[model samples]
Target: MLPRPPRTVQVLALWAACTATSLLILRLGAADTGATPWAGPAPSWGEHLRFWDAGWYERIARQGYPAVLPVDGAGVVQQNAWAFMPLLPLLTGLLTWSGAGFYPLAAVVCLAASAGAAVVLDRWLAPRAGGAASLWAVALVWSSPCAAVLQVPYGESLGLLLVCAGLWLAGRRRFLAALPLVALAALARPVGVPLTGALGLWWLMEEAQARGTVPRAALARLLPGHEVLEARQRRGLLVLVLGAATATAAWPVAAWLVTGRVDAYTATETAWRQGAAPDVLPWLARSATWVGPHLGWLLVLGVLAAGALVLSAPGVRSLGAVPWCWCVSYCLYLLVFFDPTSSVFRLLLPLAPAAWAVGRAGTRVRALLLVAGVVGQLFWVSWVWDRTVQMTWIP
Candidate 1:
């Protein structure tokens, strides 16, 4: 059969190709690592699932506060400082209490929420772009690192769902409706700060456009309604800033309530495998370091996609001031206090939505960029999973 035209057959073809590629990557990652039921003992699936934040959260769920014990030769007791965000654990506890297993319940919740996120993305972008672009958007999200979120009992999926929902609402100018969801996103992850920042920038842009560059007296008379615009913009900014701040602060407050120290969450992070903060130049150099040895094409694709966003997309350029500001801020946060793998994925989540928006410019261009990203992401995941599975098996 003759190949169908791009416009006629692209969406389903793209979706199928992406899904198949994802499954293939997963399979390759699991080829030697056969199914080991019950997360086994050797640092593999046999042992308890990769404990990190999940373990800390589970412990908090089972034991609200640690028993009083002496600290630093003093009689003061140290409560578990990791009990910061109780929402995820509390939900887990409720599920376990109701006869559902924690891990399985968490997996189901993440999957459902992620699916909901894809639905929201489709609805938000469908009207602006053709169905082809919408399909690529949802497919790219599903194929991204966020999908791995479903397998782990982490808050990523829930956080992403709320963030996407909030953005979708904001696109429609429904500021009030987006608030609670954005708040939940903040509670789930700190990345909500950039999200709120994006909205604030939008408000500022609208205000600047309202205040024309004419003589103040003449302009004031010509535009008597400028005060109304300024007032509306101020209100929008306030709602976004306050809502995001409250949501992001929720976890720290919970930690303070449980443990006397207000900075307990930061302290707990340090207890993990914390790496040194990389300087900006060194970080870029390090990311560059991986380019030629194992995968040249992948690096090239990444650069091209990022360049395309900067050069081709009007929507991206429209938010040019805000996007770069948020991107740099996020990079600074990632450098200061997170490990390499954790920093890479967590920092990328919020930006992926922006990338998706930018990549929707043309059918062929979007398809090429989307495929490259999905393939490169899956390849990276495969290598990491292999090492992780091996460590589990050996341990």
Candidate 2:
């Protein structure tokens, strides 16, 4: 029998293969749709990377954020450059100014960040789930339909890298070391704020579990007759909690400072809804319209219940308190705030803990799931890429 390759080699090989296959799939889709994959008048390799939100990042890299927010007649802010985060554009801008084109440099940045995220996720999961599951997690992430965004000039890859790295570090109890990564992640996306909440919830759970009786530990700590939490552990937990809170506030605070509007970020984000505010009634109505009147509410309830079960299930719980908290909190956030569009799948990529559960399935089930994932990826890539090029939807 041949000796098996090292884990690192295996991961990189799988990632490369998946990436190549996705690009080929995109190419074939483009050919079928009679769409040109190139971006500009003069074609380049970078042009092949351009699609959907990639254009927004490219614009920000070429020209910084608007000095003034564009508003309509009714004084509602339009969806402008500020809706995008600054980190990716900042890095891409530096590259562009140094003679690199926006598309190519941004693509490089995204791809590298995604590769780093894959490594971190695998390393983080391996200790808890074993080597095979760790590799499976990486494979599943790479082959996900939404992973096409990772290949573009978007910030999702970088944000995922930072968030996963921080979560991994925090899981190992290196709270202080994880601070900067969490801070950078906050700057990368609004989801970063919720991630802090997830971390805090995990810390509270860990503290309660450490004492063996959650309610008694709480009462004892409140009464001051017993030390539910040791001085060192308490201080470490406080620092982590505080650091994450501060980091989560960094981006919105920066937006406020720059725009002189308290709701600058939120307001800009609202523009994407085209005047439809995030309300439960409207969400339910839309759900009904899509899924049918009687079944829509049932579907919503069923999905929410199923998601709750999956996040709290033994496999996910075994990953650790922090990962469990992150998955649960992130899913709830999506349910309340985000529209139920295809973008939800892309947004869920940050919840790497969920993948750990899927990775732990038996070999036959895992193989079946992977095959289904690839099929889904093929359909998603074809539909999304075609729509993006045709200017129908944002990828």
Candidate 3:
């Protein structure tokens, strides 16, 4: 058999193909919906990228966030730009300050970031799974459900890019270099809270092993111990663990400082849900309103069990301590904090590495799975993404 092209070339070709097709589908979405006589012609791709949270990011780009939060007569915070972090908009604004249109420039930013993420993801996966499997893994990420988010003016692509890059760096014990990337990743989409947890857990495991604690069998699945770890690497891990914690806390603290309210970020985020009462399990509480308390709780338990099984699968665990820890920590973060919505799937995009587990199937199985993913992407973008005709569902 002939040799494959360079991995970067293969990855970009897949990225371009999937991206162009997704844009074509989004174009179909932009056409006049027959809801109004004057709905007019389809918009440019730049305009097509402006749906959903793009509006909020654009508001942040054009104008700085409000010093004082907006509230209704009842004194509850309203949904506003504070709900978004600044990096994507800040980059868009800086690039467009010279008279470039926001959507067009922002589109370039998102697309390029996505391309970078494809490259970084491939690099991260190759050593563990070999070149061919890793290439297929990149394709799976680009074609997964809600992949259009990468093509739009959103933070997931940029955040994932920096995050994967940071993980790659830190995995080699280059913790100093990983610091800024992790902090920026946090600002991109708030994934840092989970990242911090992952690193803290990893470091704790290493420290425990070094101190002759945590039994080898109990820690067997977690990580390789300190036998190979040097003092410098341990120091770096400690520094990185501290930095990740601070980075994870950065945005919420910034919001607090600017708004003079300790709960500034949390309050703005809840506006999307119209606020819910305090609960030990907010996810269960929200689900109960839809499906009844008993079934809702069963659903919650089912979700947790499903997540645990998926993470423990051989393929997923093979992604190594970094990806596995991040995946597990992120699931915990979602369970405690996330309110169940159709949009919850969008929040799960960072778990794309889990695709590697599924990629380890037989050739025919992989092919069938790819076909299923394409079908899933079609419905996901149609029912969840294309808001012009299908405005009832949130992606």
Q: Scored by CA lDDT, what does every candidate get?
A: 0.54, 0.74, 0.79
Clashing pairs in 3: none
lDDT of 2 by residue, 1-395 (tens): 99999887887887888777666776666555544443533223455567667777777767777666778999998987777888888877766556767788888888888888888888887878888888887778788777777877888889989888988887777778988888888777676657877887766765665766567645444332332445576567668778888877776677778888887777888888876666555456667877999988987888778887886577877776667777877887777777676676778788866787788898888888777767877777666655534444445
TM-score of each prediction: 0.67, 0.89, 0.92
For candidate 2, what is the TM-score? 0.89
Instruction: Report the Cα RMSD per candidate.
Output: 7.9, 4.5, 2.6
lDDT of 1 by residue, 1-395 (tens): 99766642454455445545654565555554443443332333312233344555556667764433223344332334353455566666666756765655665565556556666655655555446556777666656653454345667667767777887776555678888888877766666556656666556555555665344454334323222235664576568767876777776676666567765555544444332223333334445556654464566457547655553355543333334334444544555444444336544665545554554677777667666666665644444443443433111
Q: What's the distance in Å from true for residue 191, model 1?
A: 2.4
For model 3, residues 1-395, the per-residue Cα lDDT tens digits are 99978768888998899788777667776664323222335655665666677878888877889889999999999888887878898888778656878877888889999999988888887777777777777777777777888878888888999888888788778899999999898888878888888888777777777787876555656432223356778789889888989987888888999999999888998888787633347777767976898898888878878998998887787677777778888888877667777778788888877877676777888788777777777777767665445356687
* Candidate with the greatest TM-score versus the true structure: 3
The most accurate candidate by lDDT is: 3
lDDT of 3 at 261: 92
Arranged by TM-score, best first: 3, 2, 1
Tell me how far candidate 3 lies from the true structure as C-alpha RMSD in angstroms: 2.6
